[model samples]
Target: MKNIYDLIIEDSEKFKDYFLNDEDHPLRYFPKFNSINIIVGANNCGKSRFMRQLMSLNSYDGINDLLLIRELIDEYNLYVEMFNIDKIQTFIDKYSRNIAGGTILDQKAVKIQKNRLIKLKEGDFKNIISVINGNKKKLDEMLGYSGMQDDFLKDYSKIEDTYSKEFKPKKYYIPTLRTAHSLFQIIKHGSEKKLDVPGTNDYEKIEKDIFLHTYLQNYRIDKSVQIFTGLHLYRDILNSRNSEKSIRIQFENFEKFLSVNFFDSKQIDIVAKFDKNDNEKGINESELILIHVEGEKETRKLYDLGDGVQALIVLMYKIFMSEPESFIFIDEPELNLHPGMQRLFLEQITSNKDLINKKLKYIISTHSNHFLDLTIEKEDVSIYLFSQRKNELNDKQFIVKNVNRGDNSLLKDLGVNNSSVFMANCSIWVEGISDRNYLKAFLKSYCDSIGKSYPKEDIDFAFFEYAGSNIDHYIFEDEVEKEDVEIVLKDIKALAISNRIFLLADCDASKQSSKKGIRLKELEDAKTDNFIPKIVWNIREVENLLTNEMWKEILIELCNKTLVKSHEAEILLKIDKALSEVNYSDFAKKYVGEFLEEIRKKMGKISSRFILNRSAYEVKSEESFGTIINKRELSELVFNKNFSWEILSRNNEIEQLTIEIYNFITQKQ
Candidate 1:
């Protein structure tokens, strides 16, 4: 449920001896944190050095090394707090008191008894340490939890060896972009080992087939081929048919992935060439080709594409191929990509589970602020601002501060000089643009119905959107010198920023029945248990407030606006066909897909007057419906004055959300 890092330390060598020899050194431990940990620091502030230190920290075999990064000490502490070794310590204080008063036994004897108790406590800790692995169930049962002991017996490995290897997640650093730009390396692919003699024309060494475009070699000799031999597709798919079949799925999903990443207009085509013998798997070669499709007459090679484009492809390939439970340390990945692409890239890498099945922990060090876009409602990610300041003795010390969207001090750290803190009386945080738009419409409609003026934005109310897929930032931990003043960190974290705050979340297509995600569950508990003004949507998103009739009306209007006048009856039929496929219980993306497909099938060649006559959203065949239709515009145009949003005719989740906002704003006023 949470990503926990018990401790994070920097410059392992400089502090290793201090922690080992000086037991009095102060300890710093973190609360349960998110998974994606980023390190952004000033130039030469040990950003890359922190990565190197953590990776090599495990090479040493000392107790302090384990003490620093390992969660073993924390586990032992939690275990002992719940259960004690012996009850004898209860009276040890009495013994000490009597010895000091010269009333119990002789002074030396009593002192010896206390010493024995101290040694006994230390031994008890050591005994507990011997059984502490990463396995929680085993530790619980071993400490005499009754029923768990029977279940503990089932896991054979737990009983066999309590002291396993030191826990370290796998690590994989991305190769430099300079190495990836070439985009190809030739390796031998055959049944037997084919060594490259110095002068011979073997493809392993003398690889010029890609530039020469020559594949007229004899049967299965490594003379030439495989320009993209280094890529995953070339290695996995050995022949033409298999390559096409595998890439067909990629081709199917590539466009959608691009859509999510905001690359809607860009078109890429796969141009592949197999070994001359398509079925000859014995010693065959495959060359993966890519074409940049700008138009029918204009095409470009992979190298001809922009660096950001190539980096996107390369980054996905590397991430997808990464082993599970690995750390991918990427330094300055935003160098080639623009600001928009930077945000989209992080969003894609974090959530795209289909393309990336493995569990990867990305630790990117960057100078770009786009990745830190409005992370107030974000869950399971931490953005630590690294800075170095001189200590009391004028010695340099590293400082890592967990930054959140609510902290006004973060603006100062990011080099904004003039902005002051914002303390709103009441606030509402939603997930997306359309959610905000829909809520505003309902608020207006509801407030009008009740004869109360609607709350003004940023004055009477502060409406914040978590910018879909961008709602996951960390809890703030302060590092600035208070200058003899006390600052409460909890008050600065996003959740506690405003005195009365509302968090509006979608069910995420769990359909509001079950709760999922760390922040969503936290917000739910806040609303139910803490009486915070947060609500989870019953439907998937605010756009889904439109029921079947609402959808039919909207789709019919869209058809009438777009299609030819003579085809009105036929367009109505298509709208019905689209509505027949909709599952009312699901989200907009699911139900809207059917409408898009049916509309596209009949309206492909027929350009509508709304699209052609004026500058509305363009409808492209191979593009996404999102790019084709503006959902935000549609919500504002259709539902703003519709008054149906606040009616609750189909259960007004949005109307109820509007009520929470209204109450907050009214009380504040």
Candidate 2:
């Protein structure tokens, strides 16, 4: 058997010419099939249409049947081409001659010699006529010659028999708010056409009719009948003197499922029965009665059950009674169930041993988050969230977003209060507080410089400080434990579901380091594991972004502020000498190296907490270079007409990273 993926790829290539509305249709968006797939979207986001397309794909056996017929026809044509008509005629002639005359000659032959001329002439003509007739009959028998109707029936029978032997799943669609009573009515009265009138409010009526037609056709039933009529046949077989044990066992299993999932009381026994005395022919007169303790208590009908229970009964009946390997589509299984019950209902469906063993595939469209919550951390389950968006020309299209396991955004969207990060259109995860503050300030400035307004609240800023330099743990080799890796991965996955998460790693430890300095390769490698977009800086750190001129000015101001007795001219000479001697490679460390060491030595003189909190402030105030740049000040500085990011853009690494981040946030708007 071909793998499903191989089949999809092969069929897609073979059928690429087919189109719908001038767009690739059938297999255009074939979703990756899993054991269970959950589709959640607002109303009318095309979830039902997408599911129907999948059903159509599954039911498409016509192509295979056609291919089979073509192959048989080719074989028949080859047989005809190889046939020897002359050889068959020779055999017929030989048989005719043997019958017309004997090999032996006797006294009788001599006596008949007088009439031999007349007899021989007559025998020759008769033998020729007999050979022609025999040849015609033999040819007809060999070819099985037939009219158009006979030929069509023969081929159709072959196709039907072959299709029946091939194990194709029966598809059952249980639309939203489907009730057992309504389904029973549809099946009993055969009112499908009446119920499926044009422009009906219930869009699922047509789908239900299709499902019912396929089901009844499978049983070789031409018309709808009461539920009890079908059940009665099964019961009669079970009670018959010559009963099939398999039939009894199958019915027993179905009853067991109902008792376990639907009924709350063990004393209640359910039975399908019809009120034969009623004049009206409708499903309303048909009843599924629940008998209590052998008629000691009054029996209750199925309608007496709560809506939620009835819904479950209908869903389970469809599932358990469905043919194995069936594709079951249920729209909003959580429809009538409460929040807690919804979770329990999902748990029951997913955990059922019979359902699991049968290898049933389920596609459920739901609006309930409780149902979604039950799927988190589950393997073989996929969740898709659909949204409708308009293009530039105002044409609407659905955008499907896959919700990863343990995604926090799903919880947030469902109104859960446990999310730690603030809601935003875009999120950026950086290495440290300094990097976060710097990028936020830089973005604001970059926007202003480009004459674009920056929406501060629209972007979420976060840092990975759980492990010192957590960014390095992700971008480079590190000793992060397995548990810590899982935690970090979960957080990353959670943020990525709704927000576009970009990792910003500082390009540190260059010049003498063996590592490739902050390059795209690092981000690419990280992507294999985290599967999120990332950026690495070209400079060693955010502080290194300060230009040589900016460095000189900052140093000059720092000396004027800290060195109360130092002359301005002296400070300028020292600053100019430092700027000229320092290469961009180690410029940030060169200027702040001694100053940071001085502050470290005085750490014991001040409270550790105060020093830690005031560290960035001290660098900005006394050293005239803020470790955490203020957004407004940085925006003003970078937006100056003389200031240009062109030089920064010239650096390929920083340029690409900046552009990626800029595009990511802007596109969300």
Candidate 3:
């Protein structure tokens, strides 16, 4: 008759003694239950095993009874051996005196012991005792009792039951939908052959059978239902005159749940149809149907609804009607639900005032990000992430870790590939496509020079291009009425809470009227711990970082492929003249004075006469310097193995920037 809390305390004390004497016990800590707990992991990390352990403790069947008895017996023997008790008389005297004195033992203790002894007498232990009769002396000596066999036989059946009471607080397990559907088929076909009991052979089947049995026992509406069909549950609820108002309220709430969140234009009602006349088989037929009436159109049965809708209905019913303080284990509630529905379903359950008042506890195992994301902001929820580690023997050992808020590695522990922007450890927000190209090319070449692998998976870096240099979109808030400098730093600090963020901006000092370099100074002034914001220090634009030699190499390749054979030298001379004027300082100047004007005239004359037979001005105006030097092609060339890092290293500013980026990604915070 002890409550679950008292039983847990008793078990904990016993386990503490056991672990103190045996230091290498695998389980270092017992799982602590919470109002709501989540277990998340990849395919096989013992998540289901953990849930089954809880189920075993909550429900007592034959296998569990035997295991508990064995455990108690083992503990009893350990106590006897530790105290060096050598006679049956001594132990029995102590047990009897403890009961009579009303000191350490109470009536409940005697009753529990008697119950256990009675079970042993009626069960298989008689055969076990008979098999050991030939070695009675040896068994007696092992038990530290000279007449153990006769003593046990004389005391067991004579102990009477002090009271008849059952344990309170039951367990309910809703297995995965696939398993539930399979069990339904088994019940419908009347193939209720007993499966192997748990703690015996065929552990998986036994575990599934236990879950199915527990769910049916907890939710069965009528004893004569034959199978736990939805119709039976509906009929029981509708026909209960004592709780008519409560049942109607439940149905109305469910209808609201469907209408507000699922179907906007549909009204739902539960109806039952019965045939008064018996057929030739002498059976009166009855059925329960959930009707959904769409606006001015047609009505359909609930079974005609999608699988997701049906699943939600069944899931919600269980949650609403479950007893207070009950333990519920749901495996993969996200099975048939879409991502949005998954979020909504969890939200409804967690926020339901009635369910909250009931003090029910929920343990869910899932692989859905949507489900886990819902738990992040809820303070009462506990998240356990399971993973597998390979031991020296090359076997997978399961490990479970409790995930806390502000754990930056949460996404990584969930087995999310960091190549995704949402999960990346380090995210670089760039100004445009060209800026992305430049960073990627530089990172590839730098890693190659250092003899390290590029695009490393562990410290994944994701590059996102904002539409413009104004990066307020990536910033967390707009209410901080600070200067632009503080705004950028605040954005970086905010992002660094969940991820490592960096801003790559162009050093637009040449524009004279631009505020491009202000954010970098602000970042330096703020001195945030984990944010890395930098400007392109070596050049005016990202395109300016392209070395003149690389640019010439690209142009020569383009000219060889495009110009006619006879005017190759003429085209090469014109390209050289154009390149000489296009230095970093004047690249964005829009006008280059008389020196470029003369080169333009010569290029115009040559192009007008021969190349492609097009107008000279048309050819000259169509191809700007940026267009001719394709950023994509230039980036590919930079990542090539044979490309000169020696030449790139000459720009100390770029080299320093690359080293900073490498350190930011590789070093731990």
Candidate 4:
């Protein structure tokens, strides 16, 4: 599977020659394995481009791909039509303005006068009659017309306020209509043409092409492939007859045909069927029967099966079996499938580990985190974030970064406080389940005590859990543009209601750095690897004070606790009792002092824990307080006085993030 990376396309510049602005350029550095990835983003953010590029690598084709190509072609044609109409309209408007009122002269009658008296010549007679019968009766009478003149002015006077007089066709109407009709005639004929190749007759030629180019060029056609495509159309059924009741396979004319029963074969014959009344009816009402072929005798109407079942069969028979080693792109595989079915399909794909490695891989783009959660452990899997950045000129640039590779640091950059339902706006990303659960419980208890009506179910957060501790490993894209991040934030920022958006992270320490206050050296050491250090050196300096006097008693009781006591105690259950519990009575007596000291000493330090009276939603970082990330970090820091704040200083976006988190927390349904 690692050999998949043998073709690295890191230099994107080379692709610039192939398309307009290097369209559909691909990255050379992709994960190595026979695995599937789900690309997610807002529409038109290059997901399709990437998938198409991948498919081009192996020339995969199936119903989905064909459908996508058709849709794209349709869209392109629409664009061309729109452009053509806009150009024509603009030209007509410009020309009409220049020639306004010019067409009215053609319908007007010219006067025929030579020596003060009018002589009615052949053309002048028509004009003279028009003057007397049309709207010029007064002028005709003044010219001495003998017969009684008609009331020519009764209805017509160019219809005041109406612009119809200025209207005129630039050319003959039928000629233009004929040209347009001719243009569409090609479309009507081309629609019947085989998708990729031109001038090919029926499905047999397509099947033969698929076989010759794909599987059969190297080998002979087998019974399975023959039967699978043979029954695609109904016409092929009647021309050939089978000796037995077994599933009969026949290739008649240009159609692929297969049938089960003798009566079914007759049904497949494309002729119109007569009802009891014997009137000719359209064939649209006929039933389409598909043989499952999985067992001895099972035939079902095509419409009877669920969409997911149909999709599964089509994909398995048409794509999986036919297009080997090609990129299989799926958009939301969860669509129309039950959870059990989803799991079943996932397991089925995962179980074919060898086939997956040898001749198959997939790039499935989706918005469902549930689908992502199912495949967290695949080594070939990675996550990418679409992010955006705004320039000084107010222009936006979009970026796609590999979150797994630590390229852009999305979770850190965005400062999303991911929670669920209540903290619905929070970008709560967790490295493990323990942290996720603990943070949830801690938030629930803290909000409850604040008298803020914090319903456990009302906590608004979007918790994204990763299986591993390394945050960078989750990134899927290599480089993300700033515009991309902003586009993503546009959606995320909408969820915020007023809670401080905090990225609450934890720092684990070994015995050497077991002190309460985080040392500057420890902070540096934690940042050395591919991980972001959570320890705040400045905050820990103040936290260390408790270790000698107040913390000794608190630490001792916490370490030796034999029974669960308080909410904090229960929440920290996973923390070995030896490392994290305290006697409730003692904690209450000393808690006030610790909180007081935090307020006084850690007030303005960039790396110290301070007490935040407001929750995550209410906190905002002003110039005097800090940045967005800083304000957010302050709120999370306030929750635990013993935690250091050095890590918070490194993130400049904390203040804005804090306000975002707070707003998210307080937001209602």
Candidate 5:
């Protein structure tokens, strides 16, 4: 399939003239494209321009000779560049399939890179070497070699060019719609009258003058050009279509793609009508009857309604009736679409079995993230992010880089976007993501109980790391005896992570924790309102908030999931004994860490290992010290799947804490 694409790369004659893209771009085309190809980038990044180039494929004939057209003098100049005295001998020593054929840089000839190998005339080597008359054409005359030497050079150029341009993706298509909103009208002689689709050629010569109502001469169609007008093509489809199936199939597809609320239960039919003024000219053009349902079930023409939905109907009609493998490009398909509808559109385009069965490839450029992750991991989807900028030459230079399925760099960019510091009014300092997850769920539950709204992430509040127990080792908020004079701030800067802050720290049983001798007291005493404190008293960590019943459920599920050494009833008895000592009446005052520790020991004896999710599992010992990727996993399991926020929502202490947090972070004073 190497022959399927021209052996032309970025700097070569083909890619150079067409796209002034990155000169050293490694790829230009794919022989077989995946079912869906998405192009993404910042605005004005040439994603749309690149899509048009891929569309040119329908008209593209693979590499032929832009050869032979160059004069002998042109060939001479090119050969002269290749014929440097020192370099020419080196080229012969390196590439020549003779003189022991210098070892290839690659020892293996892989299937993709296999191509022509140049052979040198060994006997004429000395004669050819001595014939440097400083001119390429003159060298041929002096050495008496065939002029076909230039052909060999072109072949070698193309062979190297092919390898670099051919990207050996893991079954990824190389590169592969803007919809037209223009009203379909009567045919004129020029661009407006021509069909957008490529037409088959029959070699008929077109007359100088032809209009929709009249064709002076029956022009022989050229396979490439717009041989027939839009009207002519429309009539042609209806004429060829079997009245029972063809139009009905098209209607079915149109309905399938129709986004609900985009249009009502609408009807469409292609009808032929002739103008009485041009009575002799039958069937002046084909017209589409577009039905629309407004509130009153009123009928509307394509021209009557105006919205993206209307434009979409015309857009879809073109898509449904397009020639097989035709291109559909949409720029910012998210425009005017709610994020919900954007996802709906992605579903229809990517997963609609009919569209998939038809094997029509889509190359859409979008700024919306809804579509980015939608197909990023699908086996047959290829998304390339474009980076366009201008170079010192003041001409645009494009960087076309592929976004691999597993690469979340762009998604992380979106994540970072959602956490912009300016977007938040005040910040919450939590020790870890698991803490953040638990707190967020509890906050929402509190809001639900009071019929108040939960503040949005980032915009209302953001969470920064709390720096955990490490503060015990060295004092960050300690002032009188500052350990590091070169530190970034005078006191705990986490206090000022935003304009205002609320710190959620664990009430560990260690000395000075309850009093906050060196930590919260030092930090909060210095900046009262600026650093409100919530040292969760009586608990070692946020997980202690889970009710004893909830903990039992989680423990049981964890044992069931991971392989264990102890019997279920034995583990259950241990869990019950640990809880019996907790004494719920004194839960808010007595340290709960010992009970948790006892339960942890019991769980470990049964099965130290715990499954967080299908793909991630870990032993209890490993989670205590490191930054865990799946505290996140276990957090979701706790909050999302197992326990409801019901207990946390109504807990008197949490209710007070949630109310305080809501007021403190949401407004200025």
Candidate 6:
């Protein structure tokens, strides 16, 4: 269970290595890090080469070679070319670079410097060789020293030059942006090959590998999640002519076979729709099409989906549908998507507990402040920035810059969804008190019917106060950081749950018309979960049947039929009355009972009542009441409540198959 941060790389200091050229500074400056790192720099800053160095480090473990190979080879070639003899006398030929003759020359240079230093230190030049060599006369003779003070001194220049040459460094792999194209070449040919440095071949392979492993194998190719990672692609045969140009992504499958045209041309966009039967759809199969805007004159081209939509879909595929333990590396996730979608993506990914339970990991690199503002927690993530010093040739890279959100509300006011300040788990965003009140009750019933009682602490359902899809726009405009939105479901599900029980007396789609309200047909056409009742009527309908005074009587009869006698029926009537006058928060505590102390324990504290829109009710500071509500009571009244979610213990093929069967049966009417 090593943290993903194990890939953290240490920073580098330039201007130290004599062998490093100006271009090599950045490559050696930053240590390699883990997760998906987005290296940003203007052209010529060596960012590409930095990437190459990372690849090289990953390719080889240890092999240090500096200028040693070149110095020896060059010196030997100089001597051989100077003589031009096919065969030489044994002694002269022994002076070759490959032999110890190089070492003899090095020894001679060292002796000369030692004697000169001795003369200078003692302030005496007399008997220099006698004092320096002493009994090591062979070393002195090998140096070929003559007893002339001026001549020995004049030869000092030659010894200095030789000493400099002897101190030359060895050879080593130093990746360069210019040679990045050859990333895979070095891997394939081994370190012996001249690195092509900064070649696109390597970049292409890395990109392919990421898409294959994270998107293909773990997402689209994963059968258990029923995600078709390649659903975004489309191919249309307009006529007999084959397409001359096609933009598509291809990758290897689980069977180790290359699949081309796996997705259709970008012309048709596809999105996987999930219902109550979220697990019953195609395991690795999907469909592709286009979405037509209501009043827009043109249809949205599949490729034309906003970059935010594209980014969101891909992010969702990775975080939600991929393998539970997969590593998620998102590079500039906010790219192409609108600022609002950026926040939406962040909120979605961080709020889902299913991901945390699976031990999934996410490394996102973002430059947008909007992406940073919505974060709920800081410990789960690290923020970093890449900056260059004015005097330094290469820019510096580190986890954080000058801005510290800890002391200020910059992240909140600016709406950055850094995992630190924002919640990053399963979140169900609702609109207003009515929806919140009803969903809480309905979700309890839903979870209980499924056997694994829904634990309120792990799941949070937040209300956005009737903001509509504009909530999406708000989250986007709020921050610009690397947050991934896992999924965005329409409001239909919330409305259905609200109406099914009497939480909402009637559901209507209406707009203010000239002095009159006009009901919208689209709202009626909207679909609802089959488990929900189809009675759509105002409070008058219920009052007409029970006359309001005995409204709880009808509920009691309904509960009795379902065998939910543990809970009194009058509580339901009192709850509705309180809900009509006050918010769900106040109604829950004032009438039904204090639910916040329990809810607070489950979902962190209420903080400011404004967080969940219940600033009025003062929930007790002690004791927890998260388990007060139960879903079986309601489910038994409407349908069956003996269903179970534990179809299998392990996430294997057989378990997935069993889940498919179970989901199909439970989802059926």
Q: Each model's TM-score?
A: 0.42, 0.36, 0.39, 0.28, 0.39, 0.28
Which residue pairs in model 1 clash with each other?
377-471, 378-471, 378-472, 378-473, 379-472
Q: Lowest-scoring 10 consecutive residues by lDDT in candidate 4? A: 172-181
lDDT of 2 by residue, 1-669 (tens): 011110122233323332222242323333334567888767777676555444545322111122333443344334435554442344344444544675322222112222221111111222222322333344344344331121221111112223467444566666653454423324323554456554321211122444445544653321212121122222232343133664445445556555543443233445545464323333224333443433356666666778777666666655666556667777778777755456445654665566676667788888766666567524567787765655577765666666676665665544556453244555666655455545544554455466554433323322333233444434232234676777566544333344355666554544423454444455555453223545344455555565555444444323323342434565466556655655444544443343332332333122222221233233534445334334233322432323345545544554566666777665632
Q: Please name the candidate that would achieve the greatest lDDT relative to the true structure.
A: 3
Model 6 TM-score?
A: 0.28
* lDDT by residue for model 5 (30-111), tens: 3223456676777666676655444333232222222321333344334444554442343333333422444322222211
lDDT of 6 by residue, 1-669 (tens): 113222212223222221122343333222222222333323333333333223322111110121221332344345344552332223233333323433423333222221121111111112222223232332233333333122221111111123455221111111110110111112344564444554311111122223234533432332222222222222221110132321111111110110011121112223222123212221123222344333456654434555445545445533543444344544456656555566556644553444455444454545456454444222344343333333355534322231333324434333345453333222333334333333333343344445432322222222234343332222211122344332313213333222221112122222334111223122333324422212223211111111122222223332222223333444454435533443322322121224323222222212222111122234344432122133223222222222222321221322333333233223432
lDDT of 3 by residue, 1-669 (tens): 111110121122222222211233333333333467888878887777666554554221111123333544464445444543443334344446655765533333222242121112212332323323323454455454463423222111111223643334445666673321212221121334344432221111111344435546764422221222232344544563236676656556666666655564246555544434324222234233446555635655555678777777667766666555566777888888765567566766666556776566777898777566666544467777777665577865566666664455666656666443244467676776556656666775676586554543213665656655445434533235556776566445356334666667666543323454555555444434456777555455555565555555544443333453667787777667666765534443232122233344434544345332222112344443222234444454444323456766666766777777777777543
lDDT of 4 by residue, 1-669 (tens): 222221223234432222212223333233332355555555545554454344333111111122222343344335334544432333234324433645322133422122121222222222333323332333323322333323211221122224435221111000000100000011223556654565332221121323223433433323222222222322223322332322222122101112211122222322212123211221213323343433335454544556665444433333223223433455555555544445445544553332353344555655444444455433456555544444477653334544453333333343423452133334555555444433443443343333232222212444555443344233222234686786454433312332322333333322334542233234334332122223322222112223222332333232212232333343233333322333322322232334333332322222232222212222223212211222223323333332222333222333323333334455531
lDDT of each prediction vs. the true structure?
0.47, 0.46, 0.50, 0.34, 0.47, 0.31
Instruction: For residue 381, give model 4's deviation from the true position in Å.
Output: 2.6
Candidate 1 vs candidate 3: which has greater TM-score? 1
As for TM-score, the candidate ahead, 1 or 2, is: 1
Higher-ranked by lDDT: 3 or 4: 3
List, residue by residue over 127-215, the lDDT tens digit for candidate 1. Answer: 22222322334434433433332222111111121365434445655433222232333445473544454322223222342322321
Q: What lDDT does model 4 reach?
A: 0.34
**Winning candidate number (TM-score):** 1
Off by over 4 Å in 5: 1-421, 469-497, 513-517, 552-557, 560-629, 642-645, 650-653, 666-669
Model 3 local distance difference test score: 0.50
